[model samples]
Target: MKWIRARLADGNDEKGSACAPGAFHALLEDDRVLPVRGDPYNGHERTGEILRLDDVRLDVPVVPPTFYCVGLNYTKHIATEGLKIPDKPDVGYRANNALIAHGEDVIMPADATKVHYEGELVVVIGKRARSLSPDEARGCVLGYTMGNDVSERNWQKSDRTFWRAKNTDTFKPMGPWIDTDVDIENMETVVKVNGRESTRFHTNDMLFGIDTFISTMSRYLTLYPGDILWMGTDGHSPDLADGDVVEVSLTGLGTLRNRFVRER
Candidate 1:
């Protein structure tokens, strides 16, 4: 099932009142959206009211309890940057304030130059888990989504941490929706800048796979429902300019499109 968080385009609260007030959870069917009573982490109960898919504006699919990231997981991307591959899986963190939905503008700071996009696959956790084996790790995942890990090369290199370089507001563009059924092992990731292909790679071509990261991380901290993990991207991106539109598409998962705008 494909689940989306959206507000009706009509600007009225008629149908939205049937669900969870603000941005409601809807089941995406053909060209229609059926509002659900609850969220994906809980159980999705049908509200019986269906709206045209075109008659709504999307919001970030899930506001996770924690935003986790796996850096330097791709061998090709590691080689591209002249960096060594790590012997073990390591998890990093990202801020929720940086997250924006599809079709939103990525505000490029005025002083930021050499901005680039890292298109990645985002995993949505369904159940709370801890210290699981690779086999058990898969059971905890709800589904997958797409994320554009926008970065500033200059600040990334200068700052000891990625506080501003990567976590600036609107820097992370994620989701049109989340797919509960996707063939993770057979997916491909393609990135385009202004409608032209910039990077493409086998989505599962990571130095360490999803099971490795989940199983490894669960050893120390608890993985709760609504927590998201961004699987790192492969290859590199060209320097993005203001007004450039970036589209990150994964097999089965819908494309996430965002435009970059330089703050004046």
Candidate 2:
């Protein structure tokens, strides 16, 4: 089942209502995200009214407890650039403040150029996990979603840490909804810019899959519910500019489309 966090277009602004801030979980049904009344973190009980998909605005699916990401996880993605393959998965942290929902604008700082897009499959943790084995990792996942890891290449090359390069506000575009049922090994990622295809690769082409990252990270720190793990991207993207529309399509996962605008 596909799940979303949204507010009703015309509901009351009161907390816990359909109009409240990222108010509640909604199940997708025939062009609508019907609000699931109960605690989505625990159960899928229907609590209140249903909202049509067009009648509600999408929000970052969940307020993640921690936002984790991996880089160069895809073999083809790394090999394409002739980059060295790492012996182990390289993990990174992204700012939740940078996250934007589908249809939001990704700001391109006027002084910065060489901005790029990395279309990735994102993992949403459903249960608390610690020191999990690779086999146990799958059970902890609630669902999968899509993400666009927007980067500023120049800043990336100069900064020791990817602060401004990767954590710039509006850098991460994820959502539309999370799919509870997907074959991780069979998903494909396709990226487009201004209607032109820029990148495409299989989701499972990763040098290290979800199991590796979860197990590895869990060994050092606890992974909590609502934590998001971006599985990284494959292929390359041309430098993005103002007025560009980027669409990241991950097979069964809905497309996450966002426009780019120069920060004036």
Candidate 3:
């Protein structure tokens, strides 16, 4: 079942709805499309009364209580910048609170010299999990969404710590929608800046896969519904600037697009 969050006409309220990520998906089992008694998540099928998807503004799929992201989980990305490989997962660095939704503009900091886009595969947690085994991590995943880990390269490389580099308001571009039950294997994680392809990465090359990522993080924190774990990106992810159109696409799921503009 595919789930989406859309901003209502009021411009302040959001209504979750049911929709197919692609034309091939079935909405019958989707509680967001059709109602069923005593749904597990209490998700109601509130379709039609709400405006059509093309009409309503899209937002991030989940207002996550936490956003846990990994660094250098993909080998291709490591090789792209001529960086050394680390033995264990790079579990430091995070971006919370300032995550921007899909179709939202990514603000380019006025003082910043350069801001680059890092396209990645992010997991949306549906089940609450704590200290789960690596083998059990995939089950906790609610689904997946496309994200661009927008960063100020000037700020990022300035210091060893990454907090400042990742959190400028509107730096994160989330959505088009969250796709459930996807086979991420061999899927293309592509990034395009201003209609030109910038980076191409495959899910198959993830050095530490989703199962490993979930299991690893669960040992340290509790994974709850609406929690997000962004799997690292692959090879030479590119940069975006003011007036640029950015699109990230993953196979099975559709493409997510956003615009970037300089902050006044």
Model 3: per-residue Cα lDDT over 109-168, one tens digit each? 788777778888888888888998877778887788888888787788886777768877
Please give the CA lDDT of all the candidate structures: 0.92, 0.85, 0.71
Off by over 4 Å in 2: 10-22, 79-82
Global Cα lDDT for candidate 1? 0.92
1 against 3, candidate with superior TM-score = 1
Please name the candidate that would achieve the greatest TM-score relative to the true structure.
1
TM per prediction: 0.97, 0.93, 0.84
Q: Residue-wise lDDT of candidate 2 within 15-49, one digit each (tens)?
A: 35543364677888768667775645777667557
lDDT (0-100) at residue 72 of candidate 2?
81
Q: After superposition, how far is residue 213 of candidate 1 from its true place, in Å?
A: 0.5
Judged by TM-score relative to the true structure, which candidate is superior, 1 or 2? 1
Superior by lDDT: candidate 1 or candidate 2 = 1
Relative to the unseen true structure, what is the C-alpha lDDT of residue 30 in candidate 3, on a scale of 0 to 100?
A: 24
Task: Name the candidate, 2 or 3, with the larger TM-score value.
Answer: 2
- Pairs in clash, predicted candidate 3: none
Q: What is the clash count for each candidate, in the order shown?
A: 0, 1, 0
lDDT of 3 at 133: 87
The lowest-lDDT stretch of 10 consecutive residues in candidate 3 is: 22-31
